[model samples]
Target chain A: MSVIEIKNLTRDYGGKGVFDLTLSVESGETFGFLGPNGAGKTTAIRHLTGFLKPQKGSCAVNGLDCWAESPKIHGSLGYLPGEIAFFDDMTGLDFLNFIAEYRRVKDKTRMRSLLERFELDARGKIKKMSKGMKQKVGITAAFMHDPAALILDEPTSGLDPLMQSRFIELILEENKRGKTILMSSHMFEEVERTCRRVAIIKNGRLATVDSIDKLKAAQVKKYVITLENEKAALAFAKEFAEEDVSETRVTVSIAGNIRELISQMNKYPVAGISMPGQSLEEIFMQYYGGNKNV
Target chain B: MFNATLFKSGIKGGIKTLALFCAVLTMYYLIIVQMFDPALGKMVQELAAAMPELMAIFGMNLNSATLTGFLASYLYGFIIIMFPMIFSILSVNRLIVRHVDGGSLVFLVAAPIKRRDVAFTQMTVILSGLLALTLYVSVLGIVASEISFPGELETGKFILLNLGALALHMFIAGICFLSACIFNETKYSVGIGAGIPVLGFIIQMLSNSGEKLEGFKYATFFSLFSTDGLIAMRPNAVWGMVALFFCAIALFISAIAVFTKKDLHI
Candidate 1:
């Protein structure tokens, strides 16, 4: 059984909404939602969380209609918004108690553990807390309930690197306990660590949905090399196909010949050699494009 | 059904504003009732007889000897309506639109409940605050009257007067809450929320000036609670109260319906 399901959900807000997007996460499966900003990741999550009513299709959770039965459907679901805003007047503890009581969860052992694991102090007022601290509070609120299913949008957006890894562990732990989670993020590493199946969306549409192992296997690396002269650049460019070659600089793409490419490039008088992180779009181009070349 | 947790949280959030209104309005109600010495009342009535238009803007009747007319004009006229309207505008807008704009509303509706229930709970909190304000006026009016001038105020007519005022503010609260639900941005919600009441005050003031401006009275929601009917202690203005009740219910229902169907950017 799928814990979260979105089918052809469509809402066109001028130029900023999801269109006919459909996806689902099976029970106990950690599904990674990968997309750039304004790619409708949050919009699709909003639909699953029942914050938005679908325009063309339907969103269901645990076999219940999300729009009409949001109250019942989301009762056992934990939702962490991408941009979190708490009641400014209350302390973090107060907000947590407020949510706990709101959810009617009596036992708070999990809430305390979540707070300790996140290294958060629930004493200070939320308005005075930093953005990162507020995000932690949001995470605590989402995880403390011990929900059956969790829907998180950019869950690690403001956490530090250490905390991000800790969050990945938290998700993995919950996954072991048979909890379903659908997380949206921009970081491939985190998604790679915890999410088994990942979905990529672009321009309000699903670009691709595949397993993490498959995507990582198809990943390509781009290297930029600034040579000593045009002669060296041309010699290096001759070995590799045309990427971008100037008089003294050459950019190259390496798929599976990193060792060979490095050895070949070292023969030249290299001034600067650098590799840039591939964005989601670039990764998609390489992940899908590089396979055809093989 | 209402969410108890949300209802409790809402009341806590609203208590400070509710207390401020109750304190300020209670003091004003006490002072206005205390100032009603017969000699001064005669003097004000005589003075008002000279420039009726000036006193009319404040909604004060010229023929003012009884305590009911005195309290109606001075207490129930201008600042009384203004303060509660301010509370309604701020609180309702804060509860609904600001929650969406600030992104806190995501927590409430995301709970295991219907969107309409969230809307209903917040509306209940707002209406309950408005009810507190009206009830304070009624209870304190009776207690204050006993302390200051016994038998001077007809208790029956006083209750009718307050019921009329409650109906008016309920109607006002509904319109403000509707604005809060319609607009996602706080500024737009507040713009319409505050604008409607201030506009009503202006129109009511103009209408109270004379017959030529009476048409403008109908333009404002305040016209449903006639100052003349309130001062005259006519308990039979059933149509006016009925209109106010229906308008309030209609606007409130529309707000809930819009909220459940509307897409939130959260």
Candidate 2:
């Protein structure tokens, strides 16, 4: 059964909000929501978290209406907002304690473990902490209760590379625990590493929703080859029908099996072969029709 | 529904401001009660005769020789109304508008608590703060009066006067709370929350300035709690308290309703 469901959700703020959006995440599945700024990713997540009321349709979590039964639904839901804001007057530990008290979390074992894993010194005042430290506090608050479902928006925005990797490991560990998770991010590699399925939203509409494997399969991979000489480069470019040929380098785009390219490259005296990393942005650009606004 | 944790935190947030207001009120009460004298009453009346407009603008009527009437004219005229109104405006804005505008309210609503419960808890905090301020002033008034001039203070009428002031402050708090709930931005909340009551005070002052503007008294809610009438045991004073109490109850209810159903951009 789907643990989270948004059906025909519509909230229009002068053409900036989500419109007739529908999506669902089944129990124990890790879903990725990919979009640029002003793409209504936060809007849809807010509806699921019950912070927004749908203008025309409805949303629900765990078989309960997101708007009408938000309090009941919140029992099993954990949400990390994109823009982190905490009580500046409180220390990190004091803020965590306050949330724990209201959530009725009697056992502090999980909270302590999360703080240790994040390497966050929570005794310091929140206002005195850096942006990355504040993000860590927000992450701990969302997961301290060990909810069945988690919704995180731009969860790793302020973290360093080391902390971002730690967050990915944490998400993977939670997924293994059969937790339903939906995360939104601009970092394609992060989504590619963690999510099974990804949904792309553009201009308040769903662009596409498919498995990560299928999207990768459809992505065009570009390879730049540095030959020994310009004569050899021309030959290779002609052989592959490549137009982006320079003095001693030829760039080839391969969409199908690489076996043919391997055999073809073996025939040439290739000095160096470097394959540029293929990002989801290029794939999104395909859908965006080369629009640079993304 | 109520959340004790939220309430405690809210009280912690506003206690300093409440204490500041209480300290100021205490100083004022001490000075006013100690300044009371039968001879001073005649002196004030003579001064009023000389500058009738200035005395009338402040709503000070020191013609009566009794302590209750003297306190009524001096304290209730402006000090009591302005202090509690300022307290309510600041408290109500901090309780609801600050949280919502700053986006910290998402933490509370994201928990297993309903939006209605959150709004109700904040409303409770504002009311509790106001009650504490009123109670402190009431106790100080009685103690200061009894300590200096024993049995000369009119205990019954003084209690009634404080009760009337409390009702008026509650009504003022209701206005502030309603504005806080209706607006999502701090500027709008503070503008409307502080604007209405200050405007009412101005109107009340204008009405008291002269006989030609006496009809302006009915335009502002401040005119409902008439200090002189309450001291004289007038029926209108009791009715005014009742009206203010009901209006407060109605405004608070509507605020909760509006908050529960409104879309929070936070």
Candidate 3:
């Protein structure tokens, strides 16, 4: 059974809100919501958290309505908002304790473990903390209750690389404990690492939903080849109809025919070859760009 | 529905402001009580007669023959009403509008507490603060009157005056809370929340300035309190207090309803 569900949800704010949005996350599965800023990622997530009342359809969690039964739904759900705004007057520890008190969490064991794992010194005032430190506090607050389901919006946005990896490790650990997780982010690498299935949204509409492996399989691979001379590079560029050629370097994109590229490259003298990491931006441009129908 | 954690935090946030207002009230009430001599009352009445227009504008038209009348004329007219109105505006805005505008309210609403419960807790905070302020002033008035003039103060009439003032300020707080709940921006909340009461006070002052401007009294809710009438035990004074009390409850109930159903962009 799905742990979280949003069906035909529509809240039109003039021209900028989600319309007919539908998605579901099964129990114990890590689902990714991928979108650029202002693509209604937060809007859809707000509905699931019951911060928004759906104008048309419905949002439900654990077989209860998100809007009407929000308090009940919140009993088993943990959320980290996209924008982390804390009570600036209180220390991070005080803020966490306040949330714990409201959540009726008697066991401080999980809270202490999360604080230790994140290496967060929660003594400083939240307003005085750096963005990364505030993000760490937000992460701890979200995970302290050990909820059955987690909804994280751009969870690792303000973290350093070390903390980002630590957050990824935490998510993986939570996933191992059979927790249902729905994480929304525009960072392709993090989503690639954590989510098994991803749904891409564009202009408040669902563009595509597929497994990460399939998307990776269909990724366009770009290879930059440096030949012995400019003449060889020009020859290779002409042969492959490649436009990104400069001096003795020629860049070519291969969709799936790597053997054809290898056979074609054997005819030229290759001085050096390098492949850049594939980004989601290139994938979007190749597949979902310019075609609104998709 | 109530959330104790939220209520505690709300009280903690507004306690300092409440304390400051209480201290100010205590000083003003004590000093005013001390100045209640028969000779001084005659001299002040002569001065008020010479500048009747100015004195009337400040609601100083009461007969200052007794301690109750003296306190009612000097304190209840402008100081008590205006100070408590200012306190209601500032604290109500802080309790609800500041949290909603600054986005800290998301943390509270995202908990297991219902939206109505959050609004109710904030409303309770504002009411409790107002009650504490009113109670302090009442106790201070009786104690200062007893200490200064030993049984000269009419305790029953004084208590009635304070009850009327409390009812009036509760109505004022309802306006502020309603504004806070309706608007998501702090500027709008403060604008409408503070604007209505301050504007009413000005209108009431205008109407009190002269007989030609008497019709302007109908334009402001401040005219309903009628401090002199309540001190003299008029029947209409009791009815006005009842009306103000019911209106306050209705506004508060509507505020919670609006907050529960509204879509929070935070």
Candidate 4:
């Protein structure tokens, strides 16, 4: 069952286009939306959450159109916006209480547990909270309803490594409870560690959607080979058409055929061999085409 | 239920607002007490006689131009325009600006609720807050008037007249709230919201002193609850003011419509 179905969505604001895009997430599946900064990740999430209306085409959550049936669809989904903004005047506890009222749910025990898990101070005013703390509040609010599906945009933003790890743990726990999750992040490891499938969005368009295993298998492989002797380097070059051929070491880029290439390369007296896995930044460049730091 | 929720928050916001208003008024009162000079009194008497029409525009009785009347004159002008403008701005800010600035609008909009429900709730808060503040000022203005000028005027009618004036301010405040919905940016919303009331004040000035612009009162919020019209017991002007109040309500509803359908992200 499709938890979310976005068909040719295009949203633009102030001349910055969140262009024609199409994607889907299946029920009980953890899908990763991979993109660099300003790659329309947040815009796409906003449209899904009904905070925005598509400039063209349709988007739905569980067959309910986002624009037409936001109220109903929203009830079945948990959403965490990219930038968490809170009412400063309200205490954290009061804010969550108000949110509970808005979500039409009461689970004080669960709410408390979430606060404790996030290590959040419920007594402090939201204005006084650190950025990471505010993000925790946003995360807690999204999960408090225990909705069937969670749409998280930059969910790990502003969290320290420990908290990020804890968040990953929580997400896995939620997934185990049969909750469908679509998490957008620039962190490859975060998605690689948690998501079964990943959707790479570039220029507000779907670049690729494949299982993590398949993505890893299809991922570009970079290998540096150092020749034992100058004679072996020439033979190695002759054996295979190489790239970035340097003085002692030569770096080669290969795709899914790295194993075959490596077997062929072993024909030469290779002094050193190293294969580096693709980073999130490398994959983002392969899809988005711009200068971005992971 | 919406009303109940609105009333609670609106009252909370309103109380904070009323405190600010009272503090300013108290400071003005003390200044007036300190500045009550005989030369200033005579000057005010001459000025009042010379401009009976202007006195009415400032919510002062032209017939009574003594020291007390002179002082009340300043207080009346302050409360009728400046004080109310500030009140309207802050109250509107409390509804829309506060939410946008605090990022609470994000949380509110994220819920499985109609956008109209969220906007209407804020509208309810604005209306309730304005009403409470108007009532408080009405009572306070009357008591202060009585203490300043013992046995000189009909304090209740004056209070009622002040209530009518405050009602007009509230009407504009309501428009300010609606304007907040029309504009997405908080600064723009607050600017236009605050600007419209000030424009109304300028129009009130034009209506009074600008002989060619006296007819502009029809557009200014000041004419909606003309204290002079109320004092002279002009039912037509009062009813016209009532019509303007209804117009504000229409604007308020339009705001709800726009907000519900329009895409909002903050």
Using DockQ, give the best candidate's number: 1
In candidate 3, position A39 carries an lDDT of: 91
Ranking by lDDT: 3, 2, 1, 4
Worst 10 residues of 4 chain B by lDDT: B63-72
User: Which TM-score values does chain B get in all models?
Assistant: 0.94, 0.96, 0.97, 0.78
lDDT of 3 by residue, B1-266 (tens): 99898889889988899889988888899888988996777777788879888988888874777888899988999899999999999888777887888887878888888999999998999999889988999899999999999998889999999999999999999999998999999889889988998898988988998989899977877767988888889999878888888899999999999999988888
**Candidate 2's fnat?**
0.70
Judge candidate 2 at residue A225 and give its lDDT: 92
TM-score of each: 0.91, 0.91, 0.93, 0.83
Compared with the true structure, model 2 gives a TM-score of 0.91
Model 1 chain A poorest ten-residue lDDT run: A253-262
lDDT of 3: 0.88
Q: Which ten residues in a row have the lowest lDDT in candidate 4 chain A?
A: A285-294
- Residue B20 Cα positional deviation in candidate 1, in Å, after optimal superposition: 1.4
- Clash-forming residue pairs, model 3: none
lDDT of 2: 0.88
Provide the RMSD of all predictions against the true structure, rounded to 1 decimal: 2.9, 3.7, 3.0, 5.3
Candidate number that wins on TM-score, 2 or 3: 3
List each candidate's DockQ score. Answer: 0.75, 0.65, 0.69, 0.51
Model 1 clashing residue pairs (backbone): A71-B112, A71-B113
Which candidate achieves the best TM-score against the true structure?
3
Task: Tell me the fnat of candidate 4.
Answer: 0.70
Candidate 3 lDDT over A1-294, as tens digits, reads 999998999989899989898989999999999988889999999999898899999999999999999998888899999998888989999999999998888888988998898899999899899998998898988899999999999999899888899999999999999999999998678888899999888888887888987676666789999999999999899888998998999999887668977887899999999987665667766655323334
Ranking by DockQ: 1, 3, 2, 4
